[model samples]
Structures are given as structure tokens and as C-alpha cells.
Target: MAIHPPAQEALTPPAPPAPDRLTGRARLVLLVLCAAQFMVSLDFSVLNVALPVLGDDLGLSRSGLQWAITAFALPSGGFLLLFGRIADLYGRRRMFLAGLAVFGAASLLATLAWNPAAFLTGRALQGLGAAVIVPTGMSLLTTTFPEGPLRDRALGISGTLLSLGFTVGMVAGGTLTDTLGWRSTMGLLTVAAVAVLATAPALLTESRTPDRPRLDIPGAATVTGGLLALIYALSTAAEHGFGRGDVQIALVLGVALLIAFAVVESRARTPLVSLPMLRRRTVAFGNLGGLLTFSMMTTVVFVLTLYLQEVLDLSAFGTGLVFGVQGLASVVAGVYAPKVIGRIGARRTLSFSLLGQGLFIAALLGLGADSGVWLATAAVSLASVCHLGAIIAYGLTVTSGVPNEEQGLATGLVTTTQQVGLTVGIPLLGVIATADSSLYDGVRTVVAVAAALLIVAAGVVATGLRTVSSPAGAETSPAAAKPSLAAAESSPAAAKSSPSGD
Candidate 1:
């Protein structure tokens, strides 16, 4: 008797048909994911303007008050990679829902905290929730939408909301703190979390890699510790000069541990971040561009905030209005960013936007002690447009052409770049601003450095991404592909499987 080979269906599954346009269900899914991300970004800066009032209410000391912010930053930036991988292995939907629950509970805890310790604990827990939410939410978005216009447009909207959330938080935090109280800020996050949680379970689908890899405990420990130490060092260095012993020790420890992590990953069979993945031009240079854009733009914002408050003597509320305008500009730019990416490709768009951002930032050199606020407003508003473009394009560049199996890893790196840059940039550049004898001179010098870096990064990204192609078993140019409606016939099985089908 002769035995027949395995049937074709058993060997190879049919490719999922990509949707030409987002269906009502798909659109709802996008909304919930973006809302979750927006909440994460809002928390990053919402408390900043309220710190003074929050401290007075909780009777927190100056140094202790800083922990309200740092506590959140530490875990959110540190644990992103570990949580991202776990989500890929277990289930994105499960991790996302879990994160939302944690974030909501922490926000409520923070809202009710009457003492420094309680508030700090709540903030730290919120950070832990954020670490899980950001990466998993992002991976879900990428997997939900096929790698074409749909994903690009979704990312543009998502990126815009993330930036808007921070700006809105800044504005609203001040308004709410002055009117209602500091507790209202945290309460706001709680409400947002609840809203997203309500809709996410029904609309979103579960996704994960086909293979279940063992969790790399050693890799996770080193990376998490290294990031925590690095962020702590930077935050401390910004306050007390880097000459402090503890800061020096932390910096050294972070670098050393990160180096060790690299070595361990090289040897691990199931590495948290595979060496080949980093070798990909799109991932490497794309994240490099992301780090540069997020870091420099945030640093510029920090300098401008100082300039507005100290040099110009504007009230916190007024300063927030300035950023609110920038946020509006970001919204406009985000609306058009996907179209730009479609026409020129994500790589070219990334380069062009960076160049534009650098030029506008350079225009801020005209700012002086008695200069009108309009200059900063106009410059940042225009730069923000470019900034939003770069952000959306960078997301597309980094995640485009990546396989569904590694979407978590890809998004983890993208978010790591974003969170680390946003968290670290202010401190790294704030130190420089404070070191100068003349405040105006220091601000100018910082912008000049930031501008030069953005321009340089633009060139580097353009060069690196020139000949980019997809990884094994992905479209050759997902960012550049224009999917035809006829080819985008709906597949019910694909809709059900969602990410796995893609």
C-alpha cells in the first residue's frame, strides 16, 4: 500500500484577503486602539503642569514630587520590551485588556491618594500598565490593518492622537488643577481608560505568533534593568549635575547591562530582539529616525516651555495655550501625512519631514528674552506639522514590510524609541539649558544642536532606507504598494483570524 503526502490545505493555508477600506467594525477597532494609546500619552505629561498643586495637596517635598513623574516613567519605559514579547506569545487582546484594567485601577488609586507614598505607588502601577498597553495596542493595529493605505492611514491618525493627548493633557491639566483640583487630572485618565475598556473587548480580535517561544528571562531582566537605570540616571542628572556619584554609577551600570543584553541576545535561540531584525534597514534606521525626531522635538518643547515661563514670564495656562496651538497644527498635518506617504513612500516622507522640522526649529533662533510669543508659537506650530508628519512616516517606515509573527517586536522597538526619547530628551537637553550662563544663549544653542541633529538624521535615514525591501515572506514594498479594490475582496476567515491571517 502507498501512502499519500499530506493534503495541500494541511500544508499551506490560503492568504487572507486584505480589505480595501476599513469596515465599520475595523474602524471601531481602530478607534479603541487609538484611544488606548492616547490615554498613555496623556499620562506622560498631564501631571507636569499640576505638580505644584499636587505636591501642596499631598504635602510632598520638592524631590519627592519629582517621583510622581519619574515613578510612571520608570516602569513604562523599562518593561515595554518584556511585555511586548509576552503579548506576542500569549495573546495581544488579553494583554491589552489586562493593561487597561491595571491602568484604570491605578488612575483611580492616584485620584484618591492623600499621601506621597500612595500617589507614587499608583503612578508606578500606571507606568507598568502603560508598558503593556502601548506595545500590544500598536501590534494589534498593525495586524488588524493590512500593510498598505489602510495601515498607513490608521497609523497617521494614531500618531496624531498620541501627540494631541500630550498637548491636551498639558492644557487640561493646568485648567483642571486650577479649577477643580489636581486629583481631577488622574480622574480624567480613569474615565478615558474605562471608555476604551468598554469597547475594546467586543471590537478587537486576538492575535499572536504561530510559534510559542520561551520567554527569555535573562534578556528581559537585563534590558528592563538597563532601561530603568538609564532613565533614572538621566532624570537625576537633569536635576543634579551628572557629577553625582549615584548618577555616575547608574549610567555606568545601565550601559554595561545593555552591552551584556546584546551579548546574551546574540546567543539565545529565542532572543527577545533577534540580531537579524536589527540588521534590517527599515527597522534600524527607522527607529533611529524615530528616536531623533521624538527626542529633539520634545527637547525643543522643553526649552520653549522654560523660555515662556522664565524668560517671558507667562503663566502655566498661557504656556499651555502655546502648545495647544501646536497640537492643532499636528492634527492638520496628520490628516495629510498618509497621503504624502502614499505619494512619495514612507522613506522619502521621513526625510522631507525631518528636513522641514529642522528648518522650522532653526527659525526659533530669532527668539529673545523680550520677543513676542508669536515667534515661538508660529515656529513650533509649523515645526509641529513637520513633526507629526515625521512621526506618522516613521511608524510606517519601521513597521512596514515586517511579518505578522514579529509585529510585536517591531512595534516594541518603535514604542521603545518613542517612550525612551520622550522620557529622556528633556533631561538630556534640560541640563544643557541650565548649564549656560545666559538663558537665551543656552536655549539658542540647544535648538541649534537639535536642528543640526534632525538634518543629519534626515540624510542618514534617506540613505539607509533607499533600497529597503521586506523581510522574508512579506510584500516587497508594503509602504509603497497601492492595493486595488478588486484585489481587496473581503475574506470572512481572514476577518475572523485577523492578524494571524495577515
Candidate 2:
């Protein structure tokens, strides 16, 4: 029989079945989901660009202006995990819609804010809404696009939009603030939220964990409180040296609560973050790499934003345009990330990206009063390519081997670290940038420290992390054991496959 068959047929490989194309309504659902992600990402950068003008209108001191960011950071960064778990228990669609409504309402309040109290409160509320929206929306995405090539492309596009949104927001914030005044920036988000609310509910399917686990209140409280205190302490230390009594108190309280949180998580029947998940070196180191990547890159951006606007007297719009260059590079890096990972592996890619990012940022030391704007632009944008490449890789690394039952928790953990790094960046780097005799000197100091940290993070991840291939499996919560509503089917973009930057 072997001799009778043609040699080619004997060695023939089976052809794979064709994957479903994202057609018609499927495309519409993805569009809606991606749009929401854009809005969330947009909000991150838009407000920062407006801070100077907004602070002036509110008569805030340099220190008081920080509350505008800190208020938003506290709720958005702290409540992400709590909200992520809630979305899994309750219906994801229901939570996503509710989140949009709250975010819209909050944006409206900030739009017409008459005082600092009103403005800060609105910012905090908006943050709360974002905390709910991000995880639920991503969950919807994971449920819609089944794992494989289809999901990879969908996620690729989503990841690209996320990076692009921040850059677009910076540009938009500048123009809007310059023309319509500072309030217009907030007003724009209100409009975007209203549009999203009108169309999203009709296309997406609902999903929830089958066994609606009891909320881990103790774990939630200590962790959230701890992060809030930690962020506050850092920001306070930035403005008022670390020696300040308030900073010291906050620092101490934050550490104590976090320690308590670890103990609670170890014992909880259904912990918010299972201790064992972190035993996976890839997960633990991936998050650390993610944290350092975001913290350093964001700090560099903050410093440049100030350098362009304050040191060199560039207009807000001008500053935005300059950063826009970096955004383009980030997009390129994000888009091609999967191929890069496939070729070299996630661990090595992460290590190389971190090292590259450090070198690019350190080169920024040349930026000063006398340097050309183009030179600074090139360095920042190149560094962004490296930064985003690493961030996407880290996301993949963290969620690689996570089971479906704990996908929400795993995703939440990644988002939480991202938020923390983002919150910590401006404050921690701001401290270094402000510590020296001059702003220029401070900028120099910030870059040097950030560069060194990146190298250290590279060493940590390269030597310690490992690749984890996802296996076929599904876990339904107790409530979800019954027939589930058929979903469009999605796996996280960065989970099964790597992602690209830009």
C-alpha cells in the first residue's frame, strides 16, 4: 500500500479549515468595542494636555493642579479589579452599558465644572466609569472572537487603536483647548459616550461567570485602599518632599494595607487574585516588566511635554504634534509585535525591547533649550516603539497560560498594573524632574534614572520569565453551567498571539 501511493500523497499534510471572516454584524460589534477602547485611551491623554489651562481657570497652585490627575487616577486605577470581578458576576454587556452612562454623566459634570471641587469630583467619577468599562469591554471582545487568526487580527487592530487613541487625544486636546477653551475637551468625551451608548447594546451578546462567586470584599478593600494611599503618597511626596508628615503617614498606611491584602488573598475561598497564578514566573515577571515599561515611558512623555511647552515655549498644539510622532512609531511597533514575538520569543523580545527603550530614552538627555525640536521628536518616537513593543509582549506573557475561569482575574491584574504604572509615572518622575537646581537639570536626572531602571527590568525579565502556550479548555462559573447565550467568540488579542505597536 505504501509503494502504491504516490510519494507526495504519502507525505501530504491535511489542509486546515477556513476561519470565519468578521462580516456584516460581526464587524459592527468589533467596531463598537474598539470605539469604546479608544474613548478610554483618549481620556488618558486629553486631560493632561488641558491641565495648564484648566488649572488657571480654577486658580490652582502648581500643587493643587495635581489633584486634577490624582483624583481621576485614584478611582480609575484602584477600582479596576473590583469592577472587573463584578462584570464577570453580573452580565458583561449590562456592566459595559452602565459604565458608558456613568462616564458620560461624569464628563458632562466636568465640562461645566464651576469650581475645583466640582471638577475634581467629576474627574473621580469619570475614573470610576473607566474602571468598569475597560475590563467588561475586553471581556466582550474575548467572548466574541474565538482564538486563532481571526482573533489575532481583531486584537491587533484593537491594540493599534488603543495606542493611536492616546496620540490622537493629545492632538485633539490641544486644538480643542486652544479653540473651544479647556471645557470643550471634556465636552467632547460626553458626546463620544452618548454615541457609544446608542449603538453598542444592540450588537454585543451578554456573558457572565457560571458560578457567580461571592465578592471578596476584604481583599478588594485593602488592595484598593492601599493603591489609593500609595498613589497619594507618591504624588504628595513629589509636590511636598518625601519628608513631609502627610507623605510619611500615607506611605506607612499604604504599605500596611497592602501587606494585609496579601494575607487575605492567601486565605480567601475565591480570592480576587489567586496567589498561585502569580507562582507562574511569566505572570509575575511579565507584570513587573509591564510596570517598569509604562512607568519609565510615561515619565519620559511627561518630561518632554513640559520641556516642549514650558522650557522651549512651544504651544500646547505644538507639543501635541511633537508627541504625535512617537505615537506613529508606537503604532508601527504594536502592529508588527506578533511577528516579532513569533520569531524571537516573548521573553527575549521583552528583554531586547526594554534595553532598546532605555537607550533611546537616555539619548533624550541631549534635548535642552538649545536642541532642535526634530531631534527630540525622533528620540521620543523611537523610544515609544520600544516601549509599546514591550508593553504588548508583557500583556501576552501575563495572560498566556491563564484558564478561562480566571481570565477575568488575569486580565484585571494586567490592567491594574498598567493603571498603577501610569499613575506612578508622572508623580515619581515629576519628583526627579523637580528636584534639581533647574528644570533642565531635573529633566536630565529623570532620563538617567529611567534609563537605568529599564535596563534593570530587562535583566529581571530576560533571565526569569518563560513562554507559556495556551491549551484548549473552558471553565463555566456555577451560574454559567446552563446553556450559555451563543457569543460571536473572542480570545484576548495579546493572549493567544503576540501584538504589534504604533
Regions of candidate 2 where Cα sits further than 4 Å from its true position: 1-21, 56-64, 309-315, 468-502
Scored by lDDT, model 1 comes in at: 0.87
The pairs that clash in candidate 1 are none
What's the lDDT of the predicted structure labeled candidate 2? 0.78
Q: How well is each residue in 1-502 modelled by candidate 2, as lDDT tens digits? A: 4465454443434435536477889799989988998898999878767889998898877777878877877788888888878888878889999999999999999999999989889999999999988877776776677644455445556767777888898788878888889999999999999999999978988887867889899999998899888888876665677898888899899999999999999999998878888777867888999899988888888888777877888886677778878788878886787566655656677789899999998898788676648878998888888887787677666655454556667667888888888767767777777676788889888999999999888988887764433322111123333433332124232222322211
**Largest lDDT belongs to which candidate?**
1
List candidate 1 stretches off by more than 4 Å: 1-17, 468-502
Candidate 2 residue 173 C-alpha distance from true site, Å: 1.7
Estimate every model's Cα lDDT from 0 to 1: 0.87, 0.78
TM-score of 1: 0.91
TM-score for each model: 0.91, 0.85
**Tens digits of per-residue lDDT for model 1, 1-502:** 9997655345457765665588888889999999999999999888988998888889999988878888998899999989999999999999999999999999999999978989999999999999999999999999998877788889989999998998988888888888999999999999999999998999988998867989898899999999999988887777777899998999999999999999999999899988888887888888888998999999999999988988889987788789889999999988998887777778888889999999999999999778759999999999999999889888888787667778898899999999888867777787788789988788998999999999999999888886433332122343335543323443455444544455
Best by TM-score: 1
